[model samples]
Target: MATTWYAPYVAKASGWLSDAVNLADMAQGSTVNLAVTGLSRSGKTVFITSLIHNILSAVHNPNRMPLLNVVASNRLMGTWLEDAGANRLPRFRYQDNIEAMAAGAPLWPAGTDDLREIGIEMRFQPATAPGKLLSEISGTPATITIRIVDYPGEWLLDLPLLAQSYAEWSRATLRLYRRGIRAEAASEFLSFMGQHRHDEPASDEVAKQAHDLYRAFLIKARDAYGLSHLQPGRFLCPGTLADAPFLWFAPIDVPDNTHLAPNTLGALMQERYDTYKREVVARFYEDHFRWFSRQIVLVDVLRALLAGREAFEDQRLALESILQSFRYGSGSLFSKLLWGPHIDRVLFAATKADHVPDVQRDHLAELLRSMAAFPAIEAKSSSARFDVMPIASVISTVEDTQEIDGQRVQVVVGRPVGSDKQAKFFVGTVPIRPPRPDTWNAPFLNVPVFEPPVIDSSPVDGVAHINLDRALEFLVGDRLR
Candidate 1:
């Protein structure tokens, strides 16, 4: 019997047919893929946990989410967790995290470094009268499946590498390391780089040593200096790629427009860099990112501001680089079919909003807006509706007014993490724009990490939050309707 190539074609056609059916089902009762990410310690886990809790709770007690139209209009009929097939992805530990927060002695949940997902099915009455009537006649409410994916924000930093050549990235990264505080932090790594000759024959020992020094510098830059623009993000969160020799490459001071000799240190690093982008970054986009129709990028603005000007600017640059990877637009049918799903809505939220007084919250939002106005980001602003706001996923503080210099100043009172006594915090004022050099020297902003408040385990009561409901409404309100 002669073999035929039609088997592969048949499989591809079948996949397309399946996708068409899925899209049809989505149109009737939408399935939203929501991707959430943030820098280290940016409260990504807490934000996701609270979002799920509030949505599940809102079905029973609409008051819990008054800002969400479905809940506010009493259209949210019910909610339940659908088993995300055991083999697909690791399920998010929603119950375990909720227990930690709602326990007798509330504690913050452990940070997640790996990818996880959860599926929630929401049954709701349609916002439109005709749709509601149709649902009533059928005796079945409309249902939407929301699949949320959580991953480390560090991985997001790797997206920009897809567009740069190894030599270009090396020169750019090396140049960046020599500036301001990065110079101080990268001193050890730079010294190690100086010892090796890029044109010399490749050696595994030298390559691993260089990688270790550079990774160490990246770690210190993030932990000690709060720099956020570090590249090869996987270096910080290796995950399964930890022992992969392909990741043991570091940027070198290769001259622009220079061709590296074959089998040299530069050539080996370049090859591995290309392999990393192909095997690691490209796969991530195809598998996870291309499916997301909505995204939330959590920014720990207060922490960056406190870190000083260089760190703040680095964070702004990092955000600009990361956002470039997202396909942002008013996606048309042709574009959607041809280009895959683009993120229709993106929310750049300043997390830990409760740390600031109410009077300063708008300023925080404005600052984030300014950060997002970078040239690269501004171009994408028109493609998709971009929203910048301040949100506290978990309200860890309470508002209070304090007498300062014989004047009543708004402050927030909260128990600092690891402390039993409550203390009031007033971080002067947040500037609406990036501060000038002189202004930066004024008052140091010292915002403490506050312990999370006690949360009720029941969904009816919901978790305390700031602007979470409003944020949710802006991201997926139209779809819910």
Candidate 2:
């Protein structure tokens, strides 16, 4: 029986099993690849920068947090910065553009259109038996290596489209935007597709008007819908075809009603979209990812809910879709059969908790639990896993909220991007978090000058507890053995 093999089964598990009949080969120093992905400008880079700082700066003197305690309590478990071999790890320095983000200007992140890699090296010290034979290492540190990489979140959107075809994608795309929340863009796209229904236009008299109109519609749709995922950079590429077919076809309300000319704009765009699904998305699924020991999915839950209920519901559906895409051996599975072990645990992190006080962070976690269908537990499950914790990295306290008399206003405070003199308008409440079980509210109605701790290029005031350490343990804890 020749079955259609999704990437996860064929590329990940199949290859892994063939290489390791006894599974001892599977035990070769476990590699943990943690991906921080979401929509564009969603603070991924900043979060990653902050995470590195915490891990490098965290000391073992205090066992207050469970993460360091796990390392400290175990005599055999030790950690350190690793040698990069010929490729040395870069200094844990801040991105020069971060200051701009801290100010008011939004960042478009460096490698959205292209693929880039950032690696960090960590030297590990494994625990040894106290009274063992000659080879037993005791009271001495051992060395192992770990690496972390950062990539563009927009690439993740393609994971779902891999299973779709040109006609299926055309229909689904039209249906998604037509009646869905982003309808205006759909209507405009469909109108553009209506233009080149018959013969392909001749070169000298190519129907550029329709193309220009469609591009304008895409721009407007992007602005209206906050679609940072749209690859406008590709549209503006230099050369002849740049002005041709792709610029003309828009998302259609009724693609079935429109006639697609064999050599016209509609045909070209439909082809490109399909090509993107197969070449970029499917290729990545087959070759790039391996099922890991653990996964951390960062979600900006509050921002989604505040965007409005429709956006809120849409986000919830998107979360479900994303989880479905990661299922092992499914039609949408991403790993190959010979890949690494299946992910045993998934950590759903509610990010940006610093905006609120510490007391209410739990509420954010609770809110996430309410939104998702499967909090945990799925088919083809791996070992020991459960949902736990809501965390705020790079914690900080707000100094003041700009207001006049009783009227609230934002002033332009000097940040990274703008040349304004006044602080931006703000809903005043210094970020503060109390101990657990206390609800999130403005606890400090009268406190003045709440300052955050000093850490070079840190995103928030103080370092939140257990964020980086716990991430390390989850990603590489088993590898030491």
Candidate 3:
């Protein structure tokens, strides 16, 4: 019975688990591998840039993050980056991003395209009385090494696929594509599938063709319709896996209970799908996600609201899929010792709060909470803390009032990139819940890509933001204390 049971365990958890296990780290300092999980263009890069900048700037202008308990209590001594040589992962290009943003003509940093990690050291005075007394006696400054990990957002949608078989996933994807705006975009792939049977002889060429067409449809659906729920999520960013055989397989029509014969198209697909689950998806889950004790899930709620009813519904389904896929819970003292650590705290934020007026920011957060099933997700695990809020990592607009239809409405003024003239945009009233069919009028909002404000590359003049302080407080305050 030695090999009878598949011993479920972690892989490459040595460096990852050290944050939880190493006595040296536990005694002298602690490390929190905070994972930033968000869909593409959800301001993850900007958030990371602003967060690190502000943390370094806290010593200069404590006003930037007054809500962070460490900063509020004046316990934050200073912050600095750790050596990148310590970790084998590629370093996040923070200075290059800052330089790009701080150039004579300002620009926002590019979104994350790879798996990068950065470690920041925060030296602070102990917040707890006993810890403060011990710190005084030992004459050692309390420390926390915050290692932030960022990866392509498309990889996030892959989490749900881990639970689905090739047939099940194909069925669901085809069914969803047949309805709403997706049908038009998927017409080519659907028509291609109409001529091929799943039981046909497996041909590498045919499989690759289908994968290409399906990928094209996914790209079209995303670009033309602003859809974010596409699967095999890494298709767009092939990277080194570009020509991998596992990625050559695509969904085909197959019955739920029908057996895929050996060397059949469906069998190849099923095999490749399983291989992908075991190799690609599982590796990410083990190497990165499992190590995270804290996570920030960023949602561009305003973009969903602006992308029309169908896209909004698509995002809703995506959020629901994520909720159904992952169980976020804190490990008990017993469980942590036995099975390592689990994500204990999560912050689900509605990104780009600057798009809405001050009066509507809470509405933005509430709308995101509803869309993401925040309350229900939180209720499932009382031990874990899941909070939803609206945040703008980089403030790019100024608020003003304008008369619209004989009523004064709040508007935001910003210089949209590639245009010299500043535009005043009045994003329509955002709903706190999904809108009824009749109420969802087309062209609800016009969100423009604004240029970054004049910024000082020096950390002392951290970029302006909204609710970022509170977000930090929720994320790492306990560790500081």
Candidate with best TM-score: 3
The sequence of per-residue lDDT tens digits that candidate 2 reaches over residues 1-481 is 1222332343353444342222221212333555555544444555665555444444332242347433455433333343444543232234553443343344322423233234443333433221111013222233334455443444555465665555555577556655654666546555655554434543323335544654665455444553333332233221123343433433322245566566654565566566555545555545544533455666766555444444555566666655653555443344432245555666667766554444556677777766665535443453225353465554444324455888754332322223233223232332222122343332222211112223444432324543555655665565443
Could you tell me which 10 consecutive residues in candidate 1 have the lowest summed lDDT? 18-27
Tell how far residue 106 is off in model 1, in angstroms: 1.5
Global fold similarity of model 2 (TM-score): 0.64
TM-score of 1: 0.90
lDDT of 1 at 16: 41
Give the per-residue lDDT of model 3 (tens digit) for 132-245: 644664568788899998776677678767767889998988888888779999999989989898999998888889999999999888777878788887786564476788
C-alpha RMSD by candidate, in order: 6.8, 10.0, 7.2
lDDT scores of the candidates, listed in order: 0.81, 0.45, 0.79
Clashing pairs in 1: none
Q: Backbone clashes in each candidate structure, one number apiece?
A: 0, 43, 0
If ranked by lDDT, best first, what sequence of candidates would result?
1, 3, 2
lDDT of 1: 0.81
- How does model 3 score by TM-score? 0.91
Model 1, span 19-101: residue lDDT tens: 22332232256678888888888888999999999898887667768899988887888998878676377888898999999
